[model samples]
Target: MSEKKKSLKITDAEWEVMRVAWTTKATTSKEVTAALNEKTEWKSTTVKTLLSRLVDKGMLGTKRTGNKFIYFPLVEERSSIEILSQELLTKVCSKKVGKVLESIINDSLLSVDDITRLETLLKEKQKTAVKEVPCNCIPGQCQCHLVS
Candidate 1:
């Protein structure tokens, strides 16, 4: 995959369609719609529209096989997830990132191995982490503790 395709902002609807393409590797619109329809109430046209949007975003590649088009992801799933994670992290205040992560961890169901991995990662980060993370949010966004 090209570096340019490494980061993509897929919409919620497009993400559902991409999940099918990523899992299937290569699939037709009919197959994609069927897979998604098992849990969603989207129409064939809706799925097809999302497919087209993904193709436009360069997230999904296409091949014309007979009359139907076979769609496949141009990027790997893991890389896309990392990029999206970084993108989301950048949107929040630096000081609040830890709390954000903690909330996510609290809400998630992780296996023993997953918890172990997180502990290891935290240890590694502890070595270089600052004593305090300064507020990175705009003045209006964060509640200042300093007295006026």
Candidate 2:
């Protein structure tokens, strides 16, 4: 299977429509509208507008089912999350990565098993990078404590 990538910017309304598409793949406009109407206060016309925008942005694909158009997500949620993560990292100072990670680790309600898995991953990464890696942050900006 070919992995086609597209840079589609998601808006709030578009995100709502995408949630429905992700749950029910190859869904019709009527199905999406019904789902949104049942779940949110958005009108059918608003959902239709979002659907058309998504199709125009190439984030969604359409196929004819008789006289109706069925919409399928061209981009998966995981891929979009990965892209957003990278974008966030790029925007943040390199020195802050360590401090940010530390905060996240401390603040998150991770289970014991999750902590164990994170430790295992850290050990693997430590083994791979024997030497200290350079900061991804701007000079003098990174607060990353990369060294053990």
Candidate 3:
């Protein structure tokens, strides 16, 4: 299958719609409206509008099914997470990645198994990485390439 590299920023309302689309594979607009109506307190029209907007944003693709449109996610959930994480990391300082990780680990409640799994992954990464590599950032944009 061909891949589309564009990243779409999902709004709060759009995220709800995306959850339905991603889970259902290909769902009709009417089905989506019925499914989300009670939870979001949104009318069928609102759901239709959200679907149209998502399609325009390139996050979703719509195919004609009878008189209605069936929606499918053009972007996978993991791909979206990677794109957002990269964007966030680029915006924040490199030194802040550790701080961010610490905050996330502290705030999240992990089981002992989860903690062990993460620790194993960290140790594996440390072992696999080779000698220090230079950061590819432009000189003025980030301190990543700066030498002490």
Superposed by TM-score, candidate 2 places the C-alpha of residue 35 at a distance from the truth, in angstroms, of 3.1
Q: Compared with the true structure, what per-residue lDDT tens digits does model 3 show for residues 36-85?
A: 98898888888999999999999899889678778999989887778877
The TM-score between candidate 1 and the true structure equals 0.88
**TM-score ranking of the models:** 1, 3, 2
**Against the true structure, what is every candidate's RMSD?**
4.2, 6.0, 4.9
Best by lDDT: 1
How far does residue 85 in candidate 2 sit from its true spot (Å)? Answer: 1.5
Stretch of 10 with least lDDT, candidate 1: 1-10
Ranking by lDDT: 1, 3, 2
Best by TM-score: 1
Estimated TM-score per prediction?
0.88, 0.70, 0.72
Full-model lDDT, candidate 2:
0.77
**129 Cα displacement, candidate 3 (Å):** 7.2
Report the lDDT tens digits of candidate 1 across residue range 1-148: 1124234677878888878888999998899888988789888898889999889989999999888898999988888778888777767777888998999899999999999999999999999999989776656766754538
